[model samples]
Target: MRYERVYVIWDLYDGVRTGVADLDGTPHYFASQYDEGPDDYSDNFKLYPVGTEFMRRAARNWNIYRAWERKFHNGETDLKTHPGHGGIDAEYDELRSWLDKQVVLLEALPSLYRAKFRELPNQEGLPGGMLRELEVTWSPSPV
Candidate 1:
């Protein structure tokens, strides 16, 4: 018997949490990772105060990672240099590195700011944590 590979569609979203638009105007980011499954395995969205550059780059690189992973898993031959400067794998590595650095920065935020991420009362599609913890800092709570 033969088995097929599963390619999960990973996506990112940045926006104000529902019902909290009036409370907090700041936007948050979250990633949703799932395939043709019933439920959406997306994590809580979090704010990323590092600026739009980080978010833009992250989205672009994520697409690269998704495409590359599919190619690698399916044993595709075009796993060579992509539109980016380095090879496909290299581009993926760069994305990982950038992500790691961002995580570290999030972790380093002062406790006062970091606590906001956890204090979010409603988990209504809002960012729960950073990529793992790089969630942005906010002045007011969106409760």
Candidate 2:
């Protein structure tokens, strides 16, 4: 199935968000939050169409990030003593660098693809709807 959009649900307060759809808007192949998680029904979202190589790379990087996370958590939690610390750390750093680069590119590529976000209703006297175009940001995990 060819995906034409990406569906991302994020926490505005904690930056703990996960992608719910594929590069083209279908659910990710692997079972994840997209399949069954708290955010499955979340109303807050950022939707972006698949348009550029950078966006594609971000999706791929997210896949790698998931794999790394599984490996990192399933085995060794101690980076200082893990046998594959060098390789693991290198991969982690690379992911971090890619994340950092995304931040920089957000300013440069704002016009490449228009992005939209939807917010849930609240009683804080704030209006909610499709607000403004916000650049995409990825947080590997909750802080």
| TM-score for all models, in order of appearance | 0.34, 0.33
| Inter-residue clash pairs, candidate 1 | 44-127, 44-128, 45-126, 45-127, 45-128, 46-127, 47-136, 130-134, 130-135
Q: Would you list the clashing residue pairs of candidate 2? A: 3-24, 4-24, 5-24, 5-25
lDDT score at residue 140, model 1, on the 0-100 scale: 25
Local accuracy of candidate 1 as per-residue lDDT tens digits, 1-143: 11111111133334323111111333223222232355653233333333455555566666675455555545663545443435446766686577557644642222111112322334344333322212223342232
Candidate topping TM-score: 1
How would you encode candidate 2's per-residue C-alpha lDDT over 1-143 as one tens digit per residue?
22133333322334324433343333331112231456452323333333355455555555554444455555634345432344655654565466446544432211222223233335344223222222232222221
Model 2 segments beyond 4 Å from truth? 1-42, 50-52, 76-88, 103-143
Worst 10 residues of 2 by lDDT: 107-116
